[model samples]
Every structure is written in C-alpha cells, then in structure tokens.
Target: MPTLYLLKTFSDSTFSLDVLIGEDDMTEHVDVVVAGGGPVGLMLAVELRLAGVAVTVLERRTDIDPTIKAGSLNSPTIQALYRRGMLPELEAARDENMRQFAAFAAQRSGGGGPAIPRFAGHFGGVMLDRDTIDQDDPVLVEQAHLGTLGLVSQQQFESMLERRARDLGVDVRRGVTLTGFHDTGDGVTVDTDSGTVTAGWLVGCDGGRSLVRKQAGFDFPGTAPEITAYQAMATLRGTEALEVGWHVTDTGVYAYGPHPGRILVAEFDGAPRDRTEPVTPAELQAAVRRVTGVDVGVDAITSATRFTDNARQATEYRKGRVLLAGDAAHVHSPFGGQGLNLGVGDAVNLGWKLAATVRGWAPDGLLDTYTAERHPVGEWVLDWTRAQIAIMRPDPHARAIRAVVADLASRGDGATYLATRISGVWQRYDLPGEHPLVGRSAPDLAFADGSRLADHLHDGRALLVDLRDDAGLRRSADGYADRLTVLTATADDTDLRALLVRPDGYVAWAATDAADTGPDKYLGLWLGAPVGD
Candidate 1:
C-alpha cells in the first residue's frame, strides 16, 4: 500500500490517505492520468483531488520553460487564481507593472478622463481600454487590482500555479512523456517515459502537437498560417525612431515596444518558420531590419520565438477514455495572449465534471459537457484571432476596415463590448435555469460582515447560501453533507434571499422571491444523488 496524499491545505486542509498503488499485472494505478504537467494539467489534478479522486500528472520537461511565451493574464484567470488562494503573492509582484500602466494611462488621458479598459489590451493592433468597458465593479480581485489590466510574466504565473498544485498533494511527475495510451473502454492504459500506468481516464495537457490527440485520432482541422510572428527581448540602443505601438507598414505589420528593451517584428512570410529550432541572434536582428527598415544595433538577444495564426482545434475533446485539454485540444495565434487564459479556462470548466465522473456520481452525460461547452468557446477564440489577422493584412480593404473599427472602438458602447469580449466577461453557459445569474459567473456577493461569496467555496464544494436562514433550505443542504456546503449570511445586498453556487463560482440556482423551491432540484441536477440518498 502506498500513502497517497490529498490536497488538505489551501483548501479545507492538507492530509494523506493510504491506498494501493501497485497491484497484480500493473505498476501503479490512479483514478486519472494527466499527460503534460503544465498549468492546465496541474489545475485539473487539484480539482480531481478536491472531489476526493486520486490523480497523477506526467510532464515532459524536468523544469519549467524559461520562455515567457505568454505575457498577459485576463480577468477570468485572475478570479480563478483568487479562488485557489494563489493570487496574493503574484498580485504583490504585479504592483510595479500596475503603477507604470496607471501612470501611462493618466498621462495619455490628461489624468483620469473618460473610462478606458483599465489595462491596455489590443484588437489587431488597436488598443482596447478597460476603463471604457461597461461592466459591473470587478468581483474577483482586491480593491487595488480593480479596473487594472495587470501583466505577469508566464514564468511567474506558471510557477505559482505549479507550487499551489503541488501543495494540494498532486503527484506531478516531471520529465515524463506519454508515449501511447489505449482506451480499453472501461479505463485507459497509458505508457509514459517512465513506465505504464492505468487509470479510469487519460488527458493530454501537452502542447498543440499533442501525442495523445494524434494517437487517439482526434480530427484537428482549421486555417493555415497567415504570417510568421516573432517576439524578441534584447539589449538595444539608438532606435528611438521605432514607434512604441503596432504599425502597419507598406511591407508588413510591426510593433516596437512599450518596454524600450523589447521589440516585435512580424513578416508576411506565407509559412511560419520552424519553431523547433532555437531562434538565432542573427535571425532576430535580420527580422528587425526587414520589418522596420532600420539597421538597429542589437546588444544581445535574450529570447526569441515565432508563432503563427495557424489555428486548429480537435473536432472532439475526448475519444472513449482519452481526453484532451489546453493546447492539446486547440491552438491559435498568440494574439491578445488568449492561449494561456483559454487553456486555464478549459481546466477550470472540465475539472469538476471529470472528477465527478471518476468518483462515480456523475450524472449521465456529465463528462460530455466538457466538449459541448469548451469547443464553442474555442471556436470563438479562433475566429477572434482570425478577425484580428484579417484587419492586419496590408491591403486597401483591410486598411479601410481597420479605420472603421478604430473609429467605432472610440464609442463608449463599442469599447465596452470589445473590452468585455477580450476580458472574457461575457462568457456564460446555457445551464438549465431561468435566473439571469444562473449561467454567468456568480457575483462576488458580499455578506453583511464584508466577506464575499468566494470565501465559502475554497473547499471546492457546491454552496447553498441562505440569506434569510430559512430552516427548510438549511435542512435541504444538510442532506448532502460534504458535497454541499450551507452558508448562513446576511447578504451585503438584499436583492436575493438565497442562492446555490457551484465550486467554480457560477450560480447554480437562486431565489429572489423568498420561495424555497426545494434546493434538491438543482442540487441533484448538479451534484447527483441528492441529500440522504
């Protein structure tokens, strides 16, 4: 017997349990085997354990990637981190960047004028301001982080999530690769770089070219590359003539930097360069010259990488017992830095459903919703990227359309819509409910004591909040015990008498008229087997 640990701390508490690992005809077995121990895979592991399932995460690299491939984390992602209690330290480090942006916005707007996107985001090359966005006050972040589009290097963000996942006792195996997997229908036998392990499910959190997706024969079809995009960080001098924002040149589109040390160069080269090979300093310098028509001096190139709008997606998120998440399921242009945010969103949405399936309480077709919900969202993101690429084309039609959008983006409503879409604020599911908040992210409703709704969901269980403290509703929740948590609070607002919230902080049900329609209806629909089953 091996002592398997559960995520006891940072949630309810950290603890370990005894379980059989090696059994007859096998090396070890877990309820879930996750390939590619990046942000998404690790997040899924934590979600599974929160539901009391054993999970093992296998990653290809021995260490975190040094490349800062992603540079932005959006609002939804910030909320996810806050839910997991991993936001404070990262927020602490983000102070300087926030201050810099704040100062820049003040200077640009003559010191606090009309609202903008709080942080600078872009569509194509056009800037989208957060202050201009028409949204409720942010519910997911602290007061200091409100309305501010904050930036954290990919390295810092991934390291934090990885640490948080490990603290939850997830078995994250590094330097391990998944060579193959067989979905025997009942379960999956996965062969990895280390050895073979069997599990009830297998998920590939690997990158775009996913072995699991390839071996499982998931159909991935989409547009090819429009252009090769290059991002570089280097030591440079004597290039002040280079513009600080996106530029559509006669030749191609290029952006110099908000950071004086960095530069972005895009060439309308039909095919993207081979990213497998390391980007050379000479290559980066040459790219700079080609885009800017400037023989800029480069002291040294710290990092260089290339990407394309070669978007593709899996026709299905899962095949039999094999599933996919993150880049394995979809790949897109890195425009607006949605790649990481989208992958993290996938992990959060799929986590609880998959865990329920493994724990044997998943209602019929519960796991299937993973694809149903994410695939469309993935499609939307791909089109969003494609739309950006459309306007960046160096042609009369593209230039004219770009001009019209730029003008429209200045309108309050237009900017708000763009900001909301870019921040993923409008993302809502069509669940079985009529309540307006049912399919949307639950408002961080404040209690009379100032404690917000998320305070009760750290345990990753469904929450039944009774503002009126009605005995019937209270008893209704008590039936589910650990699966359903009941909270008694005088609401910070009096709009609703009570509500039910899922672990992901979405409202499952709510009652505004003080009528207790029996919490069992919604509870069973979501958590299975109602109370006192």
Candidate 2:
C-alpha cells in the first residue's frame, strides 16, 4: 500500500493523496492541479495565475508542432484573445491575407436549380495567406514574425504560453501523463507518470481523450463510435497566392486552400479509415491535382494524422473538485473551424469564474454557471459541424439540400445568417426574463467618459452601469464601492446609458426605463446572486 499524505490550506481546505514512485511510494499535495499542457490548458493556467490562483499543469507532450491545424480565427475569438493580451502576438504571427470571403461553385442537382451553389459575404470563410494581410490587423502586428495565427507550431504556442504562465507564477510540469485520480471527499489525489500529487481542485484541459473526465466518472452523452476525419499539411510547389476553394464533383467533395508554401486538402469518408495505413506523397499530390486541375509538386509533407469528430459533450463540466474545459468538455467535427475557437472561448469563460472561485468572492452558484453557459454552445457547435459534414456527403438528398441552401445563401439575409453562424457571433447565453437585451451580447456603446462597456472589463471585474434616472441610487451604490462600479448616465443620454452591460459584454439586466427595478436585484443577478440574497 502507498503512504497517504494529507495537506491543509490556511482556510482549512485539506487534500489527501497516496504518493507512489513505481514500486516505491511518495506523495505531494497542491492547491489546484490541471491536466494537459495544450493551448487550452496553458491558457486556463495563465488565466488562473493572473487571477492570483496557484495552479500546476501536467503535460504528456514534450514539444509543440509547427504545422497549423486550426487555420483561422473568427472575430469573437479575436476579441477573447485580445482580452488575454495575446492578440498582439497572434495577429503579428498570422498569415497576411486573413480577410473573410465566400466562395461560389456550380453543380447540377437532380431536383432543381444550379448544381453549384453561390455563396457571398463573410460566410465564405477568411483566407489566411500567412504572407500578405498579416501586418494590417490592429491586434498583433508588432510581435516578431512568428507565423500567421501568431505562433508557428503547437509547440511554439505552448512554449510562449509556458513563459507567460511562469511570469504569472504558475507551476508547469511536462512529460507527466495522468494515470489515475482518486477523490477522497476532501480533495483529489492524482496519480501521474511522474508521481502522485494531491490538490483541492483539479481541471481537465486534456484533449478529446480526457483522462480526468473519465476518472471523475462523468458521462459524455451523445453519438458514439466517432466520425473520422483526415488532415494533412503539404507544400504546394508552385503556388504563391493562398485561397480556399470548394469543389463539388459527382465523384466526391473536395476542398483545397493555400497554407504557407503548401496547400491543405480535406476529404470526408462515410466510414472510418486507418490513419497510419501508409499514404504516399504521390497519392496526396494526385488528389490535389484531381481537385484543382493544377499540378503543384509536393515538396514536403509536414504531418498526416487521422482523427474522429466525436459529437460528445460531457454531461456536466464540473464534478465536485474536478472540472473540464475545452475539448475535454466537448468534441465535434472540424467543419467551419469551430473546435479550437470554441475551446479557447471555453477557456476565457471559465478563467474568470475559476479565478473568482479561488479568490473566495464568487457567489455560491457562480461556478456551476460554467456548465450552464458553455454546454449548450458546445452542443450547438457539434450539431452545426455534423450538418456541414452531412453537406459533403455524396447522397442525393444531401446534394439536393446543398443546392437549395447554396441558392438561398446567395441572398443578402441568407448570406448574413451564414456569415454570423460561421463567425460564431450568433451565439448567446441563455438569460432569464423577457427583457429585450437579456441573453444577447451587449453592443459596444460610447460613453461621455471616453469609456466603452468592454473597457470596464479590463480589470476582470463585474460592472454595473446604471442607466436609470435616480440620483439617490447612484449615491447608495457608493456603499458597495469595492464590489461594483457605478456609472451614472441620463435616460436621454444616447451616448453612455444606452445600455446596461454585463461583465462578459452581454446585456444581462438592461433598460431604457427611468423606473427603478432596484439596483440590488439587477446587480445581484448579474453578479450571479439571487434576489435578496
């Protein structure tokens, strides 16, 4: 039997663990333990550290890969990254031609209209050329030319994130794979390849195959057997322009795009195929040639891996002292490039909440809101990606529907809707009540003080912008100065008081009404508190 070590915090928080070193045994205790050191995990660690929480990250991989897997970032994700001060570096390192555009192709469907669909507006997808439009983006043009999308490889992103985490006083240990975890009612004892460690709280930031989620006995409910996907990074010998093109042929569905000096091609199969069955360079070259009718020599092959698009979302993100974020919470197809973006968004959403929980200022139910808020978004992404994959299938019904949708997509409203869906701006968290602004992200509003609603969130604190006319309420709010910021604006003032903003930039409790709903109720709910509590 392994010797069990018990650790206690100053606040009476205690953790117990059985330490084991192969056949021998030793144990150590910690405050919070995070599994995985990928981008999502590292981002969570950094966010927690910034919030003054102590965390330790365990990573199995020794290095990151240089090849870009996720090709582009949407505007909402750009804003989230900007909040973390990572936008500058990412923008600087992204491929230059990162402007969004739609592509239209014509094909004949047996049912009707043009066989090829016409797509317009931003729904078409952004072209990240990595050569031209990189410097013009306002966020990240100044950092050393890393690679478009900010850092060149997964390893480099991890390296930079590790440096940032260290700057914020986080303990990151690499080459440590989690083997097993035990929840001893008080805390969790995590058994890793390196050693056994105990912590008051544990977060699973590991990828789709999350060991932490499994250890917690949380069920990932959804479709199983996993849909497979094939991805490869290959250099196109004679292409300088980077553009994403969609080609629909009777034989199959194929898409190609310029990536750095190479081009990436994706083929969807109705059935699973062995990823390591051995693929020749000539085979890939031939596929590209078949799709584009352009013979671009394959100078080099970076990586070819097979992955599944498992549409499974963890039944719950939080289970006792352990929590899950990013891919650990949800897994879906890579259609519309939603996986990485959604994962990063999850990190941003959970980061502040975790920090508040650690700091002891968080309300009782605030932490639980992570699952309440993100689970639906994850489910939505999975459904949408599945639809996208279905669209690429060679079935007659799918083909006909694609044709109809493509034709409908040519219109302004259809194009706008598609753009919103692809850009991820259409997502909104569920808020109670029938208020017009509730559940919708508050639009940026200009104020007389030269401040924007988003600007107030820089300190990572909840904000209460009083748009009501009662001067006495503002005076009374001064009593709770430390917990909330009171900004006064006249009802007639179109500039500042036009909207009441929530911390996450959503209009949680907003009104143009001069009538007082009582600041306490509004503020309490936005602060994740129940009325009169």
Candidate 3:
C-alpha cells in the first residue's frame, strides 16, 4: 500500500484523520479528494462534510470561469439546494437574473408587455409552462407555487457552492491540478502540481476532457456529433426588425433571443467544429448566414462558445477507490441546459453513499447502487439530447415533426409530461417499495403546525417522517438513529402517514396511515441495522 502522510491542519477547527504516519511520502490526507471545484465538486464536498467526513477539493483554476455556460438550475437542482438550506442566496440571485432578463424582454417587446413569470424553462426552444409543471412544487422553496426552477448563472452557482463548502469546513486548494493517482485497494494516492495527498476515496468532477478519467482507464463510449451548435453575443449590424425565437427554415434552424445581439444557430451539415479553436466573429457570421440565409454582419464578437450533439458516458461511475462525477462521468449537448443538472444530480447521489462507506457503517452493496441508479439517468439524458438534435434538423421532415411536438407541448398533458421530464421530477430511482412515491423524489409536504417537511433536511441527513405519534415506527427506526432523524408531525394535506426519506431527498419507503408494517422493513434496507439490535 502507498504510504499516507500524517494529519495536516484542515480549516481552523478541531478535526482528526486516520492517516499513515509518513512525512516525505505524502503531504496531506483526507477522507475524500474531489477534483475540479465546479458546482458539482463543491456540492460533493459539502455533502461529505455534512456527514461529518473530512474532504478536500483540488481545483485547478484559482477563480470562477467567466463564461455563462449553464443559464439556470432546474427543479431537481433547486429542490436539492433547498434541502441543503442554500435556497435563499440562490433565489436572490435568480430574482436578479430575472430582472435583467425581463428588462431585456421589455426592450425587445418595445415595453408595455406583460412581465414574464420567472419559471418558463425551455426544451428544444419550447417554453415549458410553469403552471402545469410545478403544480405540486416543492414546499418552502422561494419560488413557492410558481415553480421549483431557479435562474442563476453557472458562475454564480459555483461561487455560492464554494462559499458554502468553505463554511462547512472543506479545505479547498486552488490552482492545484491533479497529475496522476493510484488506487491502492484501500485508499487513493493523488499526485498534484503542488504536492502528493492521500485519501480514502477520489472523485473527478473535471470537465468532459477529464484527465482523471483518462488516466484511470475508464471506458467512455457514445455516439458522434451529428450537428454543431453555437451561441454568441456579438454586435449585430442590423435594426430591431428581427423577431426573437426559433426560425425554422428550408436551410437550417436559427434563433434570436431577448438580448439585442445574442443569437444561436444549429446546422445539420454533419460537420463538427474543432473544439480547440475559439469561436470567432467570422465563423459566427458564416454559421448564421448558412442557417438563417441572412447576411447579418457582425461588428464584434464579445463572447462565443460552441457545442455539439456528441454524447458519451463512462461505463462505470466507480473503480476501486477512484471514481468519477459530473462531466467526467458523462458528456452531452447543452440542448436544454441539462448538463449542469445531470452533473449535480450525480454528485448528490454519490455523496451520501460514499460518506457512509468512508464512515464505516455502509450497508453491503451500498456503493454499487450509485452506478446502478445513476447510469440509467445519464443514458436518459443522452437520449433526450439526441431527440432535440433530431427534431431541430433543417430537413422538411424534421420541421414537420417539430411542429407536431410544438402542438403537443402547447397542450396541458404534453406540457406537464415534458416539463416534468425536463425538471427531473420524472426521475425516480428504482427503490424497493410498493408506494407510488417509493422510488420518487419526496414532495415537500406541509404540516398542520406550519412546519414543512423540507425544513427537516437542512442537515443533509435521512429523515423518517411520521405524520402521527407512532411509537412502533419510531422503535423500528431507532436502531440506526445515529444516521437517521425521525421527525413526527401532522400533515393535513395528504393521507401519507409515513415516509422514509433518504439523505439525497428521495423516498425509500412511503405508506398510508392504514399500513400495518409502519416504517420497519425499508429502514434496514437503507439505513442499515438499528443502534442496539
């Protein structure tokens, strides 16, 4: 086994580590080492720390990326932030972003138009209605009944998560790049530009071209790019006659947005751009002309980026003590801003399970469930992006299909289904249970005392919520009381008398008041044995 270094000072607080006593062999040791300090990495760090495990984040970049890659956070992500007690700051950021977007919309509409409600998340340029999507919105969210989505820039989101991780006492090392690593069966020895560190587990949240994934020999396989997409903010040399929204034409599909100079284009030329080359004004002008057939001159290219329908995913999320998350685990098009949501979901799913393993109370096969649960979700997202790209092709047949989808999305049922899918509320894990909500994300139920179910999850721990004073249920769950919090309350809204909510905010077991088993069986399945059993 590779030798681990002695304990090092982690934050300005009392802490301890079971590190191998060595000085020159290793510089530091932690419970977990998270690579790439994006929102996914920072979120994982927070989750591990919330479970009382020591974690360190090794971020290559010293500061946040400037590009506004992901425009907003979807329903599942917002609900997760709420569960972590991080909604207030992000909600304020969302409100500010909406104000800016509304102002831009007014300018485009020439003023006096109705203000846009802050929750219309679009998929393939189709606006998902907030009213239909979030009818059963997560309770206690800042958006309330409007929706569970939040409009915050990727930069803002990552910055906020970094701050929260620091507050949770995570040691974040900036400007440190991981050069290599060795998973020595028991722990991981990670080599970085600064020095060598040892940890019980290592997770790579690095971007799509993940060095960790490459070095660890994880097989990433998927379809090639069928279309090249571009989004640019440049000075357009034209008047305000351009109508905003997708314009499907005989040649290709192009779109104009609320911002005056912001535009996007898609070409079915089957030619992918060299991603290494930065997008230029000439290239942007050429792409726009090819798709819209409009020779709109570009005076300057302020910000520009290119993506493709290239989708790929790792065969497995974990290999021994080394694992992957976020872009390192999967890569897909930014068709509907699903990349960030998918990556954050991966972190949330892996965080608690990994912590359980590191803390030494893990149920057998608990770690394997991460792959079993998230791999299918990742595949679903890949297919989602493929469908969008297929419908956006410039051919006559594609336009006909697009029209049909547009009609369906305009209807109530179709809108609800699509919105639910896009928001990730449709994604319920295959947990063991017969209850309708057994495998689904738990709805934030409100109690008669004005307390909400989401309020109890602030500490990132599992909750066994008993709607009534049931000592039998409490006794059954008391064995694992150290890791589970049993909250007894009254809910007048639903008939659900009991729910076993996991740390990641998913329902493991749910039952109506009439069920005789109470919350007994699923407790051991998820939280392991009771304390004194």
* Global lDDT of each candidate: 0.77, 0.62, 0.81
Off by over 4 Å in 2: 1-28, 94-163, 224-228, 237-244, 266-272, 275-299, 449-451, 466-503, 526-533
- lDDT (Cα, tens digit) per residue for candidate 1, span 221-297: 99988788778878876564665667778667787555445678777777665778987777777878887887787
Candidate 3 ranges with C-alpha deviation above 4 Å: 1-26, 111-119, 127-149
User: RMSD of model 1, in Å?
Assistant: 5.1
| Candidate 3 local Cα displacement, residue 115, angstroms | 8.9
Score every model by TM-score.
0.89, 0.76, 0.91
lDDT of 3: 0.81
Q: How many Å off is the CA of 429 in candidate 1?
A: 0.2
lDDT of 2 by residue, 263-366 (tens): 44444443356655754577767755554456668766776555555688888999888899988988876656677778877877787777767666576788
Ranking by TM-score: 3, 1, 2
Query: Residues 172-289, candidate 3, lDDT per residue (tens digit)?
Result: 9899999999999999989998778898999999989998899889999999887777888788865254556666667667767655577888877764648778888889898887
Q: Where does candidate 3 clash, by residue pair?
A: 479-530, 479-531, 480-530
